[model samples]
Target: MAVRTPVKFYYDILSPYAWFGFEALCRYKKPWDLDLQLKPMNLGIIMKESGNTPPGMNPSKGSMLARDVQRVSEMMDLPYNPLEHFAKTVFIRGSLTTLKTLAACQIMYPDRLEEMTRQSWLGLYSRDIDITDKGNIIQFATAANIPDVDQLLAFSLGNEARQQLITNTNEAVESKCFGAPWFTVTNPKTGRREKFFGSDRIEMLGWVLGKEYVGHHPPQ
Candidate 1:
């Protein structure tokens, strides 16, 4: 039997591009024989530490970003409401609490991490719901049917989850990450690690992993 390639996906729920990248990877997981590890990190810290200014800070760049997001969403067949939802919701609720919760799920509910992350992104980007709200966090946890919702919530709100998020963010900064949806893929054939950035780079990933370059919307 062939060994599955290890792919670490570093993401933050605050990034719509991360959502696109995450969905793309999830779609290719089985076809590419990938062992996908979801690494939840703080994108704000990455931008800050890397000295990279977010494009959304500039009005023209922000407008271009909205158009790009719409185009990408259409191309990927992924659901995204609008940049308005992003500016209104994410800026208000912030990224830390939501990411810490995801970090907690990564630790205690590894199996459910993917679904939980999807639900979180959908809540924020699709439905314009704040995933960082205390009640909404519990709601998402309950909906995912993660065992012991109370404990998970507590852990998310506690120091351990905070530390985990900090660690993940620090690692991402050390890796020279300037944005979300950062990928660190271990080539199965050569035992070498390769880094990929952005949702459009999956073909490069396929090349490194010795896999076919399936379309973004490969038939299920």
Candidate 2:
């Protein structure tokens, strides 16, 4: 049997692009024979280490990026709202909290991680929900069948899961990852590394996974 390559999907919950990219990953899964391993990381740290500022901090560039993303979302039939409030809010805090929740969900019900991840991303970008809010957290968790939101919340408050998230973030940084929606494919047999940034390279991802890329052509 040929060994399957593992694709490490590094993302931050605050990233709308990650949500879009994840949907693409789901669509490309079977054709590529790819196994995705989700790694939730702190975007703030990743940005600092990479010497890259958040999009909101760069007004002109951020606006352009937002418009581009909106176009892509429309083309892909993905829900997206480019909110002005997102520029003013403390997104890092909410992102950290969401990562904690994901960690708890992963531990308690690993099978639900994909659904919970999708819901969490949609809850933030599509529905404009305050992801940091405890009530909103519970709502998303319950909808994703997270089992016990209260327990998950408690776990998020302490060191066990929080530390794990931190560790994961550190590992991502150590591995030279620079941003969310980054994909790292490791050859199961040869230990070779292949990395891609942004959602635009889904076709290349398909090629790496030995799958056919039959989706709509990515808008130039």
Candidate 3:
């Protein structure tokens, strides 16, 4: 019998690349028989602690990264819609709501976590809806067959839920995470742990898992 590989995926919704990476990872999950562990984090805290700056903090790098994102998405035929402006404060509150709801779903609608993650990404990027919007939050949760979205949202708004995200973010930083779309792959058999950064490394991840996969690699 083959071992089911466990992958810990850490991400922050503030990044468009994280959205791209998450979707691609999900698309590949079944084929890999992966046990995906999703962990949402605060990118700002990770950057500050890790002494890393946002890719776009430098105008030149920002332009290059913007192109890189567009190029990768177009080449891979992935979704590319992005929010016009960065959510100043709306991001923290909104993401906390989603993250807490995700925790709640783990108890009741475990199977729906993937769809909820995807919908959260769509709300910010594709749908032009801010995830901080309560209506959208309920809509996404309910769509995922969540039994009581109203209660989940109410719970997420509490101090406990907010602190949970902070704790998660702190844990991520401790793991040497400096950015979104970070992954820690653990081979169940050998118990080997490996860290990888970026959506661009998906090909490498497949190679490491010894899975027969294509399209993750760039053309030579």
Give the per-residue lDDT of model 2 (tens digit) for 173-210. 88787777887886444567878888878888766655
> Model 3: per-residue lDDT, tens digit, 1-220?
5556788888876677887788778777777877887877777788899999888777888779767877877776766765566545333343655676665554446678778777877777667676767788888886777777777777776766667667778878878998888988865446788788888777778878877666653322
lDDT of 3: 0.73
TM for candidate 2 is 0.89
Model 3 TM-score, 2 decimals: 0.85
What TM-score, over all chains together, does every model reach? Answer: 0.94, 0.89, 0.85
Scored against the true structure, residue 137 in model 3 reaches a CA lDDT of: 82
Off by over 4 Å in 3: 87-94, 106-108, 187-190, 216-220
Local distance difference test values of all predictions, in order: 0.86, 0.77, 0.73
Root-mean-square deviation of each candidate, in angstroms? 1.6, 3.2, 3.5
Q: Find the 10 residues in a row with the least total lDDT in model 2.
A: 86-95
Candidate 1: where is the Cα deviation over 4 Å?
83-85
Number of backbone collisions per candidate, in order?
A: 0, 1, 0
